[model samples]
Target: MDTATLQHRFQTLLEQHRKIVFKVANTYCRHGEDRRDVSQEICAQLWKAFPDYDEQRAFSTWMYRIALNVAISFVRSNIQRERHAIELDESIDIAIDDSTRVHETDENVRALQAFIEQQDPLHRALLLLYLEERSYRNIAEILGISETNVATKINRLKQRIREHIA
Candidate 1:
């Protein structure tokens, strides 16, 4: 693809699947600075891979593959990046239904985040994507696993999280 075509395609993909970037960043980075860095890295990788995107595959699926791959690789190489504290802000507050509920959910999310931080990079990616409610088929496509394996992994991971929370 030429520059213009690639740019147009990239813009369209960005507009449609921008959440993939945020999701990947949140999964890999604990602090705002690392989140921004990971998001930029995912964007860079996506742009580099855009020309090779096969239209037959779903755009979100293809985007997820690139984003998750970059995020997993980043986390694998930088153990120190995993130690930053994540600050709760107004945005997270907005996600809460009420102050009390917010407090409870915040605690749970924090505990969940701690558990997630301990997982291997690929497991972290799978758990985050599953929590975000990605379909099993999509998860399989992104991870290059079978749908059954995706379902099994999610079930097992959820059980582990539950045990951790308990």
Candidate 2:
């Protein structure tokens, strides 16, 4: 397809799955300015990678992989991220999306948020997908890990969360 046609289709896909980008940015960044920067970078990377997107596969899954990678790299590359990093405090309940779990108590929610906030980028991505209630297969696919590895890591993360919340 032509450039305009590709851009149009890409924009439509982005609009439909834009929440994936926002959730990633909000989860990865602490401030509005950083979130906006990460979100813009994610959009640009997504557009640059769009031509290689496989139509036979799911767009949201593809988008998540790209967004998470971009967010991870953004955090890793930004010296300012270190300056803004807050220790796991009571107010650390950063909601990932509107679908944030309501069943968990506020204390548990804060603990969970704090736990997720402290993870390394790969673990953060893994937990992000896991918490989104994605299937193990999808998590593995997005993170490029084996299904067995996803289950193992999640089990380990569960234990770590127990340790963290203790």
- Against the unseen true structure, what C-alpha lDDT does each candidate score? 0.78, 0.86
Residue 17 lDDT, candidate 2, scale 0-100: 92
Residue pairs clashing, model 2 = none
lDDT of 1 by residue, 87-112 (tens): 34435432221233343246677777
lDDT of 2: 0.86
Clash pairs (backbone) in predicted model 1 = none
- Candidate number with greatest lDDT: 2
- List runs of model 2 lying over 4 Å from the truth: 79-81, 88-93, 99-105
Model 2 deviation from native, Cα RMSD in Å = 2.6
Q: How close is candidate 2 to the true structure, as a TM-score?
A: 0.88
* Candidate 2 displacement at residue 50 in angstroms: 0.6
TM-score of each: 0.82, 0.88
For TM-score, the strongest prediction is 2
TM-score of 1: 0.82
